[model samples]
Target: MNSTSSSDSNGPKSFSVNFNQDASSLQVGCRNGYRLYELSSVDSLELVYSNGAEDSNLVERLFCSSLVAVVSLTSPRKLKVCHFKKGTEICNYSYSNTILSVKLNRSRLIVCLEESLYIHDIRNMGVLHTIRDTPPNPSGLCALSINHENCYVAYPGSSSIGEVQVFDAVNLHAKTMIHAHDSTLAALSFSSSGTRIATASEKGTVIRVFSVVDASKLYEFRRGMKRCVAISCLAFSLCGQFLSCSSNTETVHIFKLEDPHNSPRRSVEESSWMGYLTNYLPTQVTDVFTQGRAFATAYLPFCGVKNAIAIATIQHQLRLLVATESGVLYIYNIDPNEPGDAVLYKEHRLDAVPENFDKTDKGRSSSPQNIEGILGSYAGIVKGNPPGQMSGTESDKLREMAAAAESPPKGAFQFSDDQEYPPLTQISD
Candidate 1:
């Protein structure tokens, strides 16, 4: 899901900042503004800087704009969004009660308040629709997001018991629901492509991935040493092959999923301490960058899938640094000429300033549509089982055989539903 604002002709003064685009260049953004510097060689892009205050009316909290639109309502005591190039006011709609969560879809508007979930049409300003599509007396929503293409909607729920659900973002349909844990679900996120889903819960920081087609659980993860850690933020790499999520305890866990099929790469960064893990796995040395003290996550758009990831963490003096959980954000540079595998980038934190709208774009379509396709042929079944204690070899083989026989690669199945199905009579959603 995404939080976006259009720019008007008279927005902030336009600046043509030419970037190195190479891995060696350093870029930064923060309370101050944006700036660039060279890696090994001493050089700077000496542009006049602006320390602007943040936009007050803008609220989408956490913004992840790939194919899906992801936003949250956790800070500022109100909804807030990431600042965009044009601007950062994704939606004009407001709520009467405390906003629990917000999701910016490519084609729809979905928000979850303290007690219910809502689906709206981005095209018409009027209420296109509403769905209390959750269990009654829902404690509240912690996180929310739509797939990159806005095909499905996901939200984390932790009420009397904890759980998470993936629904048809368009029709408010409950396609498949998982009774994930005996505890509450802490976070919900989707791969940038909208093909995979991840949910972290209090049940020992277990991160579960599911296929979009059947909404069935696929890969099971035992990610880190932090126990009972709940996820605070999630960011998918541009290529969708890697996922970065941070927890309250100043720990970021990077899980690599197999490309295309998205099968769990099976190798999770078991610990945030980067320097030593490299001794065992060579390619995984990158995990060291995520070693920051804290994080406010925002994914950057780059050409590669796993290379570009931006995370913001709160420091003692309100400083922000871009890092993966590997601690590499601080010392590692993508530049070959830079010293060490660790390259530290900079962040721009100007004196909080409101965005100048004179040159921003605010043109919004009455109805925005990001329908990739109706979910079809996507199916998987996961029964509650303790983490290890696998069935006997014979049983495991049988299970694998059964799984192979029935479960084809999920992408092969197609959603044949005509989407045009007339509304059901007296819909009780």
Candidate 2:
């Protein structure tokens, strides 16, 4: 494993960092406002612009371009859109309730409130559509595809259970709704082409991928059993071949997408025998047979840090950049063909050295100390077995897996069902 630390004294305590779609730049939000950094150089982060302020809950550089947006969580919650090159505000919007999340592409800007979503045209900030009475979302569980031509947005449906509402990027019209799980939703992500979307519920045991065109379940990958971990982020590779998910745990689970047309079929003997037994076998048996099949997993190389909140894939490589609450970044190179976990490629702190260091350090010690050793053991990535597959007592694993695979009621989305439909309350003007 590789590691590095920052000498900068003003590093953020807690930060929200996002890589532009192509991983060319990074937008960081912290207690001291938002800063845009160029990621062309691997050795150092070059500051491109700085919008200094007191606090910001979220900051994103849209589609890896010059446009940047910020969401402040403080009183009089506001959304500020600015031009990164000019450092000028293009549009500023305020809301009565806290702005839970903000997402944007070249054509659209999506601002998510607690129970509503507003879609606007990026050029003029004109409201295109408003979705109301969304699920009780506290973490702002929403995802927007990076593709411009076939862009899609996904958020929790207006229900208490795991329902996802997908909308088209061009007109913000509801395309389809997916009943993903039986619990509250945790995270949602769209494939690179926007043809498929992935959903993870608050239970966090299973991840299901669905086709956006028909809203049909495509694949189900087991994440874990026994524990209900919160998934913080989900990312799809640029080519739409692989998916990576990170949670409140140290390890990140990667699943290989099964291509319906090109996937090889099992041999006649293998399928006939297995299929016969699978029908009689319990659901737990089927789950165990499929556990960790055609997939590889990875873990954080170090210990004593929080789980990763942000994850992004580097184009044309098996590399991933993971960011934690402690302001540390981890780079891992995962081999898709291999069954083992990912290996640490490099690690560094996001902060840089203070500019006036030389002047202030003249009378102090010159030797730098190891930050991890000095800080002792704080809450960090706990190293254990990588997530996915069954663990612990056999009985416990069977019980949890059985619960996770239970299906939601059929035709529950119909009006005749008892699913709660809260009135559509528009909070944005």
Candidate 3:
């Protein structure tokens, strides 16, 4: 799999023959400007997908190890959210031109574009409402996150007591703004049951988890080392027994919120993708990221969907884009339900792609494309990531406790041509 780069920096790039793991009987659309490679090695590896099909000069590839959803975003602005089962397009939602601030439930997505917040339903790629709580600023929409009922999310001009501004996911309306952090807040998360909320800011490094019902500080955790290090990302475990946070330190901290009286049990872990950039991203281009430094920080920071958190960084360095709007993708296993080592299992990237992919009338319309196939199956779905063996942390003691039993990490989703992960049927366009 050894390889080297050529002078044609932003052009056709290759991967180490060792890492190529596309399906064996791979085929390409003759009219499509893409090709698939088969790696004799890496048997159980997920089928690596490349996206330079439209044009070789600009290319992108993507792969998912767990719950895979088909979504689309335009570089210039507008975002198209789509939900797919096997290979069919279920429905797509188009939102106004703005940076997609947050995507909550599979069907609940918040796109804070331009001067407003848009509630879109991937159920059929449609926009429910365009709520303009605050006027748009040149800085662009900062950030947003939705709650369980798809009700509220944190918004701008928020206050110390105002942890998050609740929103009506069904109708774009001003729900309520809860008094939260002491300083300019950076990120927010609602406890699983929607009974509590957590806030962090430039001034507050420790995440102050408070009860939404009483607006009382339930517990506080000291986060990062630097100043104004707000909690960049946060999420609660499935059973609502633990809380996890990631920061500018590029570290993922998992906390066992098992002990109600005591603080939540927390552990710190780093991303494993740090090496891939050197392993894959740097080959095509040399700028933006140094030998090891990725162009962008990992993102979504919290993905409970796969019972794991996802990290979006830059990659396939050959064709690089400096826009903060562009980033890579990676996933890891941090099951709050499980008691054991925080395993950072899967890592992937959305290959270096061109801006107008689905933009022009010609290509796939900024709307992502899918192969027609099944929705799901029992064979490929990996199961059992948590047991009851582990518990507790130093400062934040976990209150939740269970019996000692363990389950294996879910196997990678297997994608094949005939019946890719059978049972996963397309929702419907």
Candidate 4:
């Protein structure tokens, strides 16, 4: 969801970076405040807005919209929704625990905690539903569909194994459960269409793609056989035709979804040693070799640092954007037809402000938790119908009903589960 790393004690304090849903923009949060940049082109990163009043640990933009969701490191339990252009706080809410991750789309906003999830209507910021007692997700890892038609939210279904629970944010129910891997889950992502979901386990040797509708396995990719890597990000291209994965290593792997054999270049061949041994080895042993390999790879300047990556098409060219927590953005160009190593196009420093950028408030208007044990109180109470096509009237009604519901308080609350069944239950102290 976000990449954070510490610099030298004499250097600037820690900084956090995250890309917008489509990777069209980048947001960097630091000890002083946050900065927003628009990927106007491959050669330039336009500074749209900047704020220095408060310390922001996390800041997310809603597809270039003016609204932004922010969380301060000093008060991680509190979430503030603000209108960046107007510099006004729209609303804020506090949870019983620290907020780990937050995801947003056109229709819904999802806030993930250690063992719970809160779904809010984007229109009114009203609490639509709460998924309590989830598996202990210390990373606060979760993914939301960009397609508002079938807005699905995915999180680790099991703490011991790599299981994914897909929730229908629009319909407000659990969609299905996917047994993604044998090891614990490390990363999760949804295709642009919301029809498929990708996951990687803690082992980080394999990547799996599942059909969101049936929870059926679609594609499996073998990242490496030499070592176990820590996968940090999984992203699908806007066209949903390609998937890119990044890990703690220096190499970023890219895989094609359809017609892999037709690629101009590939990492492995059927006539190679693994291919020859496929007939002699056991089914399980040979299956690893049969799995797909990287269609293309990108090498980073440094490894083991926190970074975020995304795939996008800019100026009719496929691009890979890697933003490292060390305050640098690396842009790579990839030939879709010829799949191999990615070419580094340009690199931008996020820590530096451009001379032409405005520093005044009057400048251009800018675009912008929980305990595991207490969660056992209510387990299966959260369920939902399979997401079906909703009529316009039905969709509007759902939004209206959500907007009419009572909203949480506009500030922080020190909640206790014993005093209230649900942590957000408003009670006067």
Candidate 5:
């Protein structure tokens, strides 16, 4: 189904949108103000709060909560913390350089500048720690895991070869540093459990998942090799079993992690031969054999798509919310057990403004009157089943597919240890 927002002459020229942890609340930053809407239904939008601002560049709702922080597109960027319910500005903090990114949960708030990172206590807005001389991160790329107790943050380590600096979020102590890739870094993400970190380089062909504790490499999946691509976002499933990545292309790829705890059992005949042989081999040998295996891939539903700007996944569900540069949001429901790509479930146009949108009235009272219907149109698109649980049949099917896909084709020549492996090649979508 298709729904469009009415356009007004005074409407925002652009928009910056963010969704809460569970995808329940959506906060949109526009040129004049930021709007908070409930995403429970698509037929109507339930406006929770609306705050007027001048040239707002970013609006982020705190993880799993209603309190929000906003940043304006002005010099010496500052972040304003406000109550989403009362529309009152509780506090505001200023920075010397332009703010690259801001991340917050119930306990902490993280702000990234060009060469530094500031960690602040959320309760009283006290400065917890400041990391200086950080790697040059122009995009302001940083990731915080969902785990509260052992919260972990991952960011670029140096301006040299690609490296990731993982640290304790609470005490600001250095945990481990991973020399992840050869080219410049593109993105970094931490798993939901805060145990692993995923890194991609500017080459964008290989994505590596590393252990947060020891800085050891765990899994490496290949995205493409023919040409260099810039990765925009990387997200780990809530269960920490799958990693999803979207690049400056029309496709999104999902890679499965090696989880013996939840993996399906192998067949008796195959397990006796291949599994037994591989079980006795060193881990280093096994990793070389099993690199670059992607579970599934899908393309953006829109034609002439520029790129995927952001990606969000629901816990225990195979659904994905993908946002594109054209102000379109697509919901994809994927079946990992199946061998094919993900299918588009629904689509919503996010840039639509209300008919009576008044840019002159710069106050909270200027919120769209038909908010329920306007916001519902975008929220209702995601109304459906929550994340699905894997059944025995599906698990078995996935195992069979993974085994077949990971194995080399019969009669294919194998490279000797002394021989160099051919350059990785990109497969067409």
Candidate 6:
């Protein structure tokens, strides 16, 4: 959970917004306290719980369950796990430094500080493992998989570069390292199935997706190259077929991960001219053609504010949800057949509690209290790339090929279609 000051002068003082593991619920922490909303409906949010006893800067709901992890502004160094439905604090832990972020799954709950992380068993709220002296993560940049079986956690492996270290939280060991980018990583997220992870560097230009099983580069999408902006969030749809990225800019980019074979075909004339000039052009220019572009984009009513995004299916319609720190949630309708701008459908002010809210109605989330039912399984494993398969550096190869031959190298144009990686699967519309 990260806090950002409200950019709108008329908005609340300061707040933070975070979606639960599945985006089925949203938690907004503010100076007053926090509010939890169930997003099962597209037109309105069902106010599940609200409390103003203490100011909270971080609030993470455990996948629509009764549990929630909270960090208060008055006590930044402490973490409180409470059963929001019961209004009872289950447990609280204090740290040596201010808590930067807290992530939770059904099996594990991780508390991240500036230089260390504590992994706790969610069943009992007891410390199971400690990762000390990790690279400095001032923003507490880390993600935990919702899948209880695989239970992979990813954090920045290096302070200078965008290297991601995936750890098997269940087995408690290092899984693999992925050199995602040259710049420091700004945001990363796991697909619902945990088979793929998306990463965005501080540069905020190109977004890359890697196979969790082998740490191989799967798809690279170009956001823009004009000016750099801070990326606020990276989210994979629940179906794992679409990835949504929100930045400081007004636009939210949605990239399709569906297999190209099943996607609606486009005429070759619609392709960019750069696609045919890859061998003759510089890597920087060819990179634009080689990478995938956004399948759909949605414009925000406001800009320059930190926001989090999620893609979900609501009443059989694909909707993109954007929650900004300024205390507003925007819902956009995405057309599967269109490859352009998404239409804004609805907007709700998170701070506005519904008139007929019922705080005692725990029946909405009245599933079994079992950990397996709350978390659900959706994760996988990954190994290092095989020999001779370049994990990075497309520019170096292009430069060498330019100096070496008059003709294009053997496979200079087939970057995305390389047989080394498995083809991406398409999700049914």
Q: Give per-residue lDDT, candidate 5, residue 10.
A: 24
Off by over 4 Å in 6: 1-13, 260-273, 358-429
* Reference-based lDDT, residue 59, model 5: 75
Greater TM-score among 2 and 5 belongs to 2
Give the distance in Å from residue 44's predicted Cα in candidate 4 to where it truly belongs.
1.5
Candidate 6 lDDT (Cα, whole model)? 0.74
Q: Which candidate has the highest lDDT of all?
A: 4
Question: Each model's TM-score?
Answer: 0.48, 0.73, 0.47, 0.80, 0.70, 0.80
User: Least lDDT summed over 10 consecutive residues: which range in candidate 6?
Assistant: 377-386
By descending lDDT, how would the candidates be arranged?
4, 6, 5, 2, 1, 3
Question: In terms of TM-score, how similar is model 6 to the real structure?
Answer: 0.80
Which stretches of model 4 miss by more than 4 angstroms? 1-13, 260-280, 361-429
Reference-based lDDT, each prediction: 0.38, 0.61, 0.36, 0.77, 0.62, 0.74
Q: Which ten contiguous residues of candidate 2 have the minimum total lDDT?
A: 374-383
Candidate 1 error regions (>4 Å): 1-58, 61-94, 133-150, 259-343, 350-429
**lDDT accuracy of residue 65 in candidate 5:** 49
Q: How far is candidate 6 from the true structure (C-alpha RMSD, Å)?
A: 16.9
lDDT of 1 at 153: 71
The lowest-lDDT stretch of 10 consecutive residues in candidate 5 is: 416-425
* lDDT of the structure predicted as candidate 4: 0.77
TM-score of 4: 0.80
Better of 3 and 5 by lDDT: 5
Q: Compare candidates 1 and 5 on lDDT and give the better one.
A: 5
Task: Name the lDDT value of residue 121 in candidate 3.
Answer: 51
